[model samples]
Target: MAVPEDWMGAPPRQPVDLHTDRPHAARVYDVLLGGKTNYPADREAAEQTLAALPNAGAIARQNRAFMQRAARHLVSEAGIRQFLDIGTGIPTSPNLHEIVQATAPQARVVYADNDPIVLAHSRALHTSHPHGRTAYIQADLCRPGEILRNPALREVSDNFEAKGSHVNARSKGEVLRFFHGLDLVDPGLTVVHRWRPDTVEVGAAGWSDADIPLYAGLGRTS
Candidate 1:
């Protein structure tokens, strides 16, 4: 199969002015995930946050595990081949792309994040596979429409449909409007952890405003 020539290369890197003096969410996640991309300020902030929620590290790991499981379910059971992942934190190994691509090599993934550090690391670590595709967009969760309309995401979506599979982007309400013509999967527009929880009853009871710092949902284009 001939991959689109225009989509073959990585997106041009936009120069970012890093504010290492203050803490960023992505850097804090990197620190919590035991990555080396974080600064002292970020580490301190992460530690402070962890101090407040003693299970902060565990929660981070659990969140990653949930992402992995969800990607697997989407590829294996749901037959989804394209993904638009917003709030893509640091370039953690076995990321959403890695999990889905492992199950289905033709899976196309577009990761978006507002963090400059995430954008840099995503470009470096989240390149597309030879048989599939991946792209990173420096976009905020508050602008889901922008992400859905991104040139890179549109290209990937086109490729995904050519393979006879579906595409869905995960983000909060800002992007939900972009899926007006699509059908949301069951349990529409809920927290990531709430989707297919290990125990729905326990998960429901545990739900709190703070538990879902970010809203996520899956939808199929109609």
Candidate 2:
């Protein structure tokens, strides 16, 4: 017997409990992103979410766009050359590295995620530029100490660590708390589509907070 072609390159390392019977947030997100890496359960969950929020898919895309815009700004304007992305879900195109490294090929990025499935698909995250580098660590976001201690993340600078989080949603006050010890760049914690909103596209001119309920901000250690 032979496996179907669609089943190729689908298994993760070490055979962790995927729980395909249930919907995983990451996979549901993947589904919303129009990626085929999700299961039936994940699609059903995504549909439910869509039903509740008709623009959920648009919000997802805008959320990713916000990260790209922020990363580009950090690289082109802020002179940031190192990055640490937490909760990096499935391999999405024009990833953080792809965005930053495009402007500064010497930029280094370390993606951290606790999902075993993400670990299995980590290979896609490693296509760093020859001048730069990218690494992935299978770690939980709740354990900041462990991630900070990981050698893969510490190689660039033991004293310097730039963290980026791609979360679903957060209240204005709750989101501000993340930058407690850092000085926020101008126009802090605003709606995602409002941040920059540079790229011209259909309906881009009229995107309101109600259209995309995601927030983005940049902070620097003082």
How does each model score on lDDT?
0.73, 0.79
Per-residue lDDT of model 2, residues 107-178, tens digit only: 998888998777656654458899998777788887787889887777643565545444443578777776
Where is model 1 more than 4 Å wrong at Cα? Answer: 1-12, 159-222
TM-scores, all candidates, are 0.68, 0.81
Task: State how far residue 35 of model 1 sits from its true place (Å).
Answer: 2.8
| lDDT, model 1, position 203 | 47
**Candidate 2: pairs in clash:** none
The per-residue C-alpha lDDT of model 2 at residue 174 equals 75
* Candidate whose lDDT is highest: 2
Quote the positional error of residue 190 for candidate 1 in Å. 9.1
- Cα displacement (angstroms), candidate 2, residue 166, comes to 15
Residue pairs in clash, model 1: none
Worst 10 residues of 2 by lDDT: 4-13
